[model samples]
Target chain A: MTQRWKLTIEYDGRPFVGWQRQDNGLSVQGCLEEAVRRFSGEAATVHAAGRTDAGVHALAMVASLDLEKQCRPDTVRDALNHHLRPHPVSVLSAEPMAEDFHARFSCRGRSYLYRIVNRRAPLALEAGRAWQVSVPLDAEAMQEAAQRLVGRHDFTSFRASLCQAKDPVKTLDRLDVERVGEEIRVTTAARSFLHHQVRNMVGTLKLVGEGKWAADAVTAALEARDRAKAGPTAPADGLYFTGAWY
Target chain B: MTQRWKLTIEYDGRPFVGWQRQDNGLSVQGCLEEAVRRFSGEAATVHAAGRTDAGVHALAMVASLDLEKQCRPDTVRDALNHHLRPHPVSVLSAEPMAEDFHARFSCRGRSYLYRIVNRRAPLALEAGRAWQVSVPLDAEAMQEAAQRLVGRHDFTSFRASLCQAKDPVKTLDRLDVERVGEEIRVTTAARSFLHHQVRNMVGTLKLVGEGKWAADAVTAALEARDRAKAGPTAPADGLYFTGAWY
Candidate 1:
């Protein structure tokens, strides 16, 4: 008999070539699948709630897999963590889930956090973990501009060119910008996102933070429905898949 | 004409051998001196507020150096940071200082922060930045025990075997243990500390947190006045030289 397991994972993402298994380099999915193979002796396919891009971290990414052999939830988590040694990845928790449950399909909402170090000096402790923006940014202005992106609308201005989503429309549940000490954080939530949507929105808001674009400009860009009208996509270093709510 | 300058620095500390200049490997002082030489064309000797051990990080370590060239404070900081490229050490700020100002000798108080991630799974993003303890620790109990070591006392038991201090008696201004989510933070301040004294005290407190040793046991260890009486010294990964006050 086979049992389905739900796994919560955390990864640095600096060394991974994204969440999907790729021929070029390492992937978080590949690591988890290999760990499952080693521990359960079954060549399993691991699926994640979000397919994070290269250099994008995850705090509590939801994933699911099936194992032929019977094992305790703790055993599955511990065994996978042990096998993923020195890879900057950890299986935080594991639980037996219903066969009908799916990590991606069953997920109701997903949240992400993007970190920006607003300082003149370069980063030392957070070298690869955050995007260091040398210019000082006004978080309040960014917050106001971000509000223009919320609600159901066509996100063609924010979506990547290669986005595979069937529709360009997405309902953004929340988009907030706040400052914590020397860092500016952008938090967002939605049922699903177009490729590079979060990063592109953050990039566009940064212009407002720097006093280059106003809140009305963001609304204009959204209405224009052209990717070229919006700001550039922010780097992947600062993006984090925070959680997925069922 | 020589001008004395004060520098506030931040470093990751994983790549270097410590703050002092050494022959074996790279040091924070050596990097600063080299950067000074490259920018000012002067063989400057950089001094630090604390000579941290290997693998110990710093958030705002105060240092001083004398340069013969005339340069603005901002220029000194920017040039040194530019020349110190690729190294984890960074000069956060620079200011002109009086000749009497000394990085180590003139410091009135020093503060350090030790981070411990109390979680079952291993660290992912903060692998080398924090200590990962699998067992759950009682932070309140640890805080209560820490008060026993406060005030002026002979911390002989907590002193390192290689400590160079002339006397073991030192006044501990503060020792606090607090829990934030899954992380335990130990913050301490003192006029001066014996080598490895903070780490030793934290290690002994861990025993009390784990229920292996009682609060009185920590007092007994201090009263023993022997190095072997205290717990083992904690690793250098979790320690950070936070700041120095003049």
Candidate 2:
């Protein structure tokens, strides 16, 4: 007999290739599945709510798996954690779920947080965790300009060239930019996001923050609906998968 | 004639042995001094306001040095940062100071922060940055009990056996513990502290937070004037040098 388990996980993305298994290097998924196999002696497959690119971190990424061993939810969590000691991934929680529940398909919403250290000094403690921009950024201007992107639109200008989405339209529920001390944080949420959508949007907003672009340019780019019309895509280091709403 | 310089530094203390120059391995002080030498070809000595033990971090530690090379403050800051690229230390700022000014003797107050991750799950992102306590801690009770240690007293029970302070009496200006999300942060300020004083106090407070000891027990430990009567010393990973007040 097999049991379905839903899990919430936290990870530091620096050590793995990405959330999915890859041929070239170690992946977060591979580490988790191996831990499960070591703990339960079963070759159960694990699935994630969403896939992330290389060097992108997740705070509360939702995942699901199956097990033939009869064990409590807390026991499953602790045992997996014990086996996963060498990796930078933690099973924060585990719960029994319905047989039909799916981690990727059952999710209703997702949110991301982008961090920028707007200072001239190079980062020491936050290296590999946040992006460092030497120039001073006008956060208030970035906040005002980000509002233009907070609605349903044809986001062709923001989607990656390799995006496999059938449509470029997405309903962006929230796009907020705020300054906390020496850091500028941009947070966004939606039911779903196109490939490289959040990074492209943030890279575009950074131009407005640097006084290189204006609100009019953003509106024009959205209207153009051309991939080449928008700014460059930001680095993967600053983007974090913050949460998922089900 | 050599000129005096005051500097504010930030560092990740994981790689080095400690803040001072050690014979066994690399140190933060040695890195700064070598960076200064490489940048200006001057063999200047870098001095810190407070010496931290192995694996302790700092946000804004104050230091001073003497340089015969003439340069702008910003130039000094950027140039030193450039030379210190490979190390996990950064010079936040550099300022020309009066000849009589000294980082250690002129400091009026010092503040430290101790972080505890109060969760059943192990840490992933905060490894080596915080102390993870698997048992549930009573934050409100801990906060109420922390007030008992805020005043002038002989902290002999909290002093390390290797402490070299001439007197055990010191004025503790502030000691507060608050919970931020899943973390419990304990902040303390004093004119000066005996070796391992902050860690010992935090260790005793952990007993209070765990319900193993009470406020009366804390008072009795203080009045005993013996290190054996107090709780065990906390790990060095949780403590951080927050600031130095002039």
Candidate 3:
């Protein structure tokens, strides 16, 4: 009997090419498939809810896979973990799911967090983990400016040129920007996102954080609906796919 | 003419041997001397309050170094930062100090913070940053037990066998243990500490956190004044020389 399992995975995406398998280099899918093959002799493809990009971290990326073996859920988890020890990948949890469940299609909403360390000194422990900006940032201004981007609208200005979305419209459910200590965090949620949409929005908000742009300017950029009007995309290192809702 | 400057330095101690100069490998002193040579063309020796070990970290380690060059304080800071760009060291602040201000001898008290992650899965991003424990721990119990070791004590039970201190007695001002989420942080303060004393105290507290030993057991172990009575020394990865007061 075929059994489907939903796995909540977490990975430091620095080493992988992305979430999807590619011929050029390693991917999260490749690591999952390799671990799965090591545990079960039969090879199976892994499907993920989010196809994150290179240098993008994940806290709870959801995935589903099928196995022919009738092992216990814990057995599969332990075996995969044992085999995956050599890699930086980890499977946080695994459970049996309905055969009809699709990791990518069934996900209702996804959340992403962008971190920025605002300080004069160079980062030590958080060198690659958080985006380090030497100049001080006004997080309050960024938060107010980000609110202008929170409703259903044509996000063509924020969408990447390489984004393959059918339409430019996206309903941004939440965009909360806050500062904690010396770090600024931007949490965003949406049913789905276009490629580089979050990064572009963050880049636009950087102008606000730096005092060059205001909340009204963000509205103007959205009304313009031109990619050239938007700020440059933020780096991928600070972006994390936090979770996905079913 | 001689000029002395006070330096607040931050470093990721993983790459260097320690906070002091040694013949074997790269040291924080060696890096600072190189940066000084690059700027003033004169070899400088830095005197830090704590001579930390390898793989340890520091947030605001205070140091004092004499410079023969008549450069401004900001120039020294910026030039050192410019030259130390290739290395994982940063000069947070540089100010002229009295000639008698020795970093080690003039220090009042030193503080250290140790971090442990209590979880089943191994660390990915925080691999070298925190100690991971598979077994669950009761941090409140550890905190309560930690109070038993506070104040002045011989601490011979917690001292390393190889410790070369003249006397085992020392005044421990504070030893606080607390938990934040899955992390248990232990902060210890003292006028001075014997070799591996903090790590030893934390190791013993782990027994209390695990329900293996009680709060009174810690007091008993300290009173016994026997090295065999205390727990093993914790790993060096999670240790940090947080700050030093002058």
Candidate 4:
């Protein structure tokens, strides 16, 4: 008997190509599939709620797989974690789910967090974990500017050139910017997002934070509806897939 | 003319053998000296406030060096940082100091932070950054037990066998334990510490956290004045040299 299982995972994206399987380099999906095969002796295909880009971390990535082995949820988690050793990945939890459950299709909303170290000194402990902006950032200005990107709209200006989404329209539920000590955090939630949407939006807001652009500039950029009109895309190091909500 | 410069540094200790120069592997001090030589063209010797063990990180470690080259503090910092490229070390600040100033001798107090991830899943993003304890830890118990070694006392039980301290008696200004979500942080401050003192104390306190030992056990361990009476030394991964006071 085969059972569908939901797995919540955490990974350090520094060592992975991306969440999707690719031939160029090691990927999170490839590692998960290999771990599944090593433990359960089953060739399983794991599906994730989001295909995170290279150098993008995940706090709780939702994934699903079907396994024919009869084992406890704890066993599956531990075994997968054991096989995934040496890789910067961990199976946080595994739960048996209904056969109809799907990781990507059943997900209703997704959330992400971007960390910026607002300091002149280069990063030491967080070298690869965060984006360090040398110039002082005004969180208030960025917060006000981020509001322009909220709500439903055609986000072609923020979309990646090679994005495969059929529609450029996306409903952004939340886009908040806040400061924590010397760090600035950008949090966003949405039903779905166009490729590079969050990063492009962050990059644009950063211009506001740095006092180079006004908050209203974001409104104009969104109205332009051209990818070239928007600010440059932020680096992937600062982006984290926080979670997926059903 | 030689100038004395005081420097504040931050480093990820994952790839370092320790803070001091070692023959076997890379060390933070060696790297800093090499960076100094590369930029200043001087064979300068760097002196640090503390000699941390292998895998111990630093948020703001104070060090000092003498150089014959005349340069601004900012130039010293930037040049050293540029020369230290690819290494997980950063010179946060540099200041021209009086001839009497010294990084180690002038230091009055030192503080440290030890992070424990109280979770079942193995760490992914924080693999070598924190200590992961699968079993739930009682922060309150640990805090209570920590008070036993607060005032001036002989810390032979917690001191490393190879400690070079002239005396085992010392005063602990603070030993605090607090929980934040799934993380437990232990903070301590003192004028100085014997080798492995903080880690040994944390190890013993962990036993109290796990309910394997009572708070009174800490009092007994301290009174025993024997290394074997204390818990095992905690791994160096979780320790961070927070700062050194002038």
DockQ of candidates 1 onward, in order?
A: 0.82, 0.81, 0.52, 0.81
Better of 1 and 4 by DockQ: 1
lDDT of 4 at A219: 93
Question: Model 1 Cα RMSD, Å?
Answer: 0.9
Write model 3 residue lDDT over B5-103, tens digit each, in one string: 999888888898887789999998889888989999988888998888888888888899999999888788889988987778888889999999999
CA lDDT, every model vs. true structure: 0.94, 0.92, 0.88, 0.95
Query: How well docked is model 1, in DockQ terms?
Result: 0.82
For model 1, residues A1-246, the per-residue Cα lDDT tens digits are 989999999999999999999999999999999888889789999989999999999999999888898989989999999999879899999999999878999999999999999988888888888998988899999998899999999999999999999999999999999999999999999999999999999999989999999999999999999999999999999999999989
| Residue pairs with clashing backbones, model 3 | none
TM-score of 4: 0.99
Which residue ranges in model 1 land beyond 4 Å of their true spot? none
Error of 1 at B29 (Å): 1.2
Report, for candidate 3, the interface RMSD.
Answer: 2.0
> Model 1: per-residue lDDT, tens digit, B1-246?
899999999999899899999999999999999999999899999989999999999999999999999999989989999999999988889999999999999999999999989999988888888988888899999999999999999999999999999999999999999999999999999999999998899898888888888889999999999999989898888999999999
TM-score of chain B of each: 0.99, 0.98, 0.96, 0.99
**Looking at candidate 3, what is the lDDT of residue A221?**
94
Stretches of model 4 off by over 4 angstroms after superposition: none
What is the per-residue lDDT of model 2 for residues A1-246, given as tens digits with 9 covering 90 to 100?
889999999998998889999999989999999999899888888988878888889888999998899999899999999999989899999999998888888889999999999998888888888888988999999999999999999999999999999999999999999999999999999999999999999999999999999988998888899989999998888988888867
In model 1, chain B matches the true chain B with a TM-score of 0.99
Q: How does residue B101 of candidate 1 score in lDDT?
A: 96
Put the candidates in lDDT order, highest first: 4, 1, 2, 3
TM-score of chain A of each: 0.99, 0.97, 0.97, 0.99
Summing lDDT over every window of 10 consecutive residues in candidate 4 chain B, give the lowest-scoring window: B36-45
The recovered share of true contacts, given per candidate in order, is 0.68, 0.72, 0.34, 0.70
